[model samples]
Target: MSFLSSNPRLTQNEGLAPAYNSQSEQPFAKPPVAIESYIQDLIEQRYQEQPEASVVCAWDGDFTYRQLNNLARSLVALLSAQGVAPEVFVPIYFEKSRWTVIAILGILHA
Candidate 1:
């Protein structure tokens, strides 16, 4: 099933941020089982846990988690400002790269 099929809240465009974080008193009751369910959260955590880790490599060179998060956040701000909404289809055609990953996370945030 699609994330849109499972997460009714997607239609309402609520809870844009990750469900749990270091500041939370209690753990998020259910960590998203499907990798696609909470990609922004997962990527953010991965960056915090290991920012220097190599997450991408293209003709330009290697890209680290920190770079990916930074790119995604930038994309998020642009996309959110453009009124991108949850569960809405957005066509992003690009070859696989750190940038594409960033776009996915940004779309999630949007």
Candidate 2:
């Protein structure tokens, strides 16, 4: 999905930023699982916990967790329609940006 079409609330700056810090030590509710499983669960958990929270802050705009989840789901559907499957090498070549994050999530979910 195009950035503009997927997230209409995206605005210039507005002092948006991720609510959490990656470098900070965080506690988990449960013991750690495998990387793949953890990532999938984490994505869903974030969406559930705070759908409107900013997950990606790009030059164009900040993407909320809900928007990211929706965009990723849309990409997953597109990939499935194109016969994409597990272990398939889906090369996503985009400059470091929000779309890249969405693509990665799509590939993983697909």
Candidate 3:
């Protein structure tokens, strides 16, 4: 048995992530999730599920899940105030650091 499948033939399907799903299963079985709910879940998971988990460890500093989620939520508020919505693209430009990770999640949550 292979890591991806019991059949070694799966090796031939490299570069395709969809190969992991068996053909017996529907391609889109799960129902669509609302953007608000998805963002809320992401924030809640980071803040509530594992608040102490370190999400970013930069040379200058570090941030825990709670901090990142809080920053993300704040970004969400700012974006919402600016009338940003789903399907909208937010530009991200930041140097690699703890703040960068927080900014990425913040933009994503927004």
Q: What Cα-based lDDT does every candidate model obtain?
A: 0.74, 0.81, 0.72
lDDT of 3: 0.72
Cα lDDT of model 2 by residue, 1-110, tens digit = 57657777755432345543321234463566657555867978989999999999988677899999999999999999999999888987878877888899989999
Clashing pairs in 2: none
Q: Candidate 1 vs candidate 2: which has greater lDDT?
A: 2
Determine which window of 10 residues in candidate 3 has minimal summed lDDT. 15-24
Residue 29 local lDDT, model 1: 54
Residue 50 error, candidate 1, Å: 1.0
The prediction achieving the highest lDDT against the true structure is 2
Question: TM-score of each candidate?
Answer: 0.59, 0.64, 0.56
Model 1 scores worst on lDDT over the 10 consecutive residues at: 14-23
lDDT of 3 by residue, 1-110 (tens): 35546565644455356655453256577766657566556667667778999877889898887777778788889988998777788887877777777666666666
TM-score for candidate 2, residues paired by index? 0.64
Winner on TM-score (1 vs 3): 1
